[model samples]
Target: MILDIYKDALEYSAKDWKTLVILGVMCLFSFLLLPVFLITGYNYRVINTAVHGIINGRDPLPDFEDLIDMFVDGVKVVIVQVMYLIVPVIVFVIFAIVAGHFNGGLSTALMIIGGLITFILIIVACLMSQMGLCHMAYNDGAFSKAFALSEIKEVIEEIGWSECLMTYLGLVIITVVIASVVSIIIGAIFTVFGISGFALGVNASGVFLLGAFINSIVSMFIVGPYLSIFNARSMGLLYTMQI
Candidate 1:
């Protein structure tokens, strides 16, 4: 009966400021290539923990330790994601190239069709891949478990395709809202300060630019982990209902 995924995640995260801080720092550094893998792994780790919670009747938000294991798991998730989407991406690229060479209305039509196909395929791939990821985590990171199409389809069927679609749509809407709010707030801060700086003097503008950078980083540190946790928790809840 949880009506609000974002609210639930916010409360869960608020329970432990120390852990949130650690996750924030980790998220801030995750942009680097090496840590990117770990960050990816952490995503799976969150899903794994969520699955564990549903199955075991334990607390869902597990501690953000075990970087090495999370990194390894993350690499596998990356592979799953790539394998799922590569075909559609290739097709999209080919169509894009063809569209580029064409003229007028034909090119416009081709581009539109190509873009639509790519968008649909990407959504399908992500949903299926996520199911695969959840399964893989639940089964202890066996790479093969992630691609068990027959079993995965059964779970989807049991959950009802309509419900699954609704869940995906809901997830998208929630994520977009969260991301938009964060982006707007940060953007507004920068714009206001930046304008004031310019109005004051060149030196003030420099200071405002510096302040904007700091603000962006700090906002990222706060919002990034919160969204990650919210997503992980929401996915866990989704699968938990199926069981």
Candidate 2:
């Protein structure tokens, strides 16, 4: 199964490169929009007003300025951090459904549970492989073996667990640090200059737009694949150790 996974990944990368790229783009776009959607929905005033009116038997026509103020206040107070928890579960469930469709053994109720487990394991293996790659020197073998749990475990064991964990942790920390810095800079610009500054940065210098595009591309092609691989590798190691 591990070898077959590697073969499938390679074949998919080669024969269906366009499909993979499209899926990657779709994944990136979905993630980017997730926060915006949550924020808009959470801060929606019309629904809130209607609900309030229904409960109190009062007029639903709040003043426009008051509504706007309410929405802004809601935005400030709403726990947008809930998105962090929601998005991953949504993504995982979606991916699992897709995998079940592709694998074609999920029709039966009992089989659905098994299929979901397999999907979760596959995702974990992919993540392990990516972490492994980040630690090791750039090698085609690492990329090729990324989808294979068995091969990934072999590589990890050879390198030792302590080193692997340190490297993986370092990669995660670095990514988080960079993302934090970028967010802070963007937030500062928005604070100081407001919408006008944002427009100028996006339209005049094209910096904002360019940054968003690059971030999406990297998140899709680089980060997604690497994480998938790392997860696969890590799961394989755990299984071997258990045996």
Candidate 3:
């Protein structure tokens, strides 16, 4: 089922090159803040379309439209995410602050325990945030529905917790592998070019800097949006499974 979801997601996202490029450009300027939210809103749209398509037997990719609404929805998505993350973040910060006051093995052990707890909390937060966003989409973008804990739990239970965990873990591993490979390839290409220039008496620093700049651009404009859409589509498909 996970494999099928990814297969379809890749095909679905790549079908429209124009839309993909538009998304990539938005991702490139995402540091401006507005574009990032618009992208988030688009992801919400994808989830909505995916759910409807599952029921209607045809899920199509959504187009960019209604900027105001997309921005608003994106803000809602951010709020839902921030709310879900607040507890873990607070716990981690407070624990670190308190632990710093002690100077001994006990402090080190406490810090380790704090790190472990914080890690667990972050994982849980991410799981809940994804499910919450899907729920909000399914509920027709009702902001409150995203926080419906009981319904969220029922949704997870229906999907089977173990399967969902493995599915998400698969997604994470795939994403990390792709990122790592891209970084290595970029670094290697840049190093080769830098070495060649250095041997010719050209400054290696400039070559390395140019490589870093290009890699950053590629990551922000291409890799980031592509992965975002893939994950969004996968989540949309995952939500559709409950139907």
**Top model number, TM-score:** 3
> For all the candidates, what are their Cα RMSDs to the real structure?
3.2, 24.2, 2.4
Error of 3 at 12 (Å): 2.5
Cα lDDT tens digits, model 3, 128-151, are: 888888988898888998999899
Model 3, CA-based lDDT: 0.82
lDDT of each: 0.73, 0.42, 0.82
Give per-residue CA lDDT, model 1, range 1-243, as digits (tens): 245544554466455556556776766776676666776777677787776664333364565578777778778978998988987899899999999999999999999999999998898788788888887877878899888988878877887777766777777787789777877777687678778867777446665566667666756676666666667666655665667
Query: For model 2, how does the per-residue alpha-carbon lDDT over 201-220 read when each residue is reduced to its tens digit?
Result: 64434555555666556557
Q: TM-score, each model?
A: 0.82, 0.29, 0.89
Residue 149 lDDT, candidate 2, scale 0-100:
49
- Counting clashing residue pairs in each candidate, in order, gives 1, 22, 0
Which ten-residue region of model 2 has the weakest summed lDDT? 134-143
Better lDDT candidate (2, 3):
3
Worst 10 residues of 3 by lDDT: 51-60
- Show the colliding residue pairs in model 3: none
- On lDDT, the stronger of 1 and 2 is 1
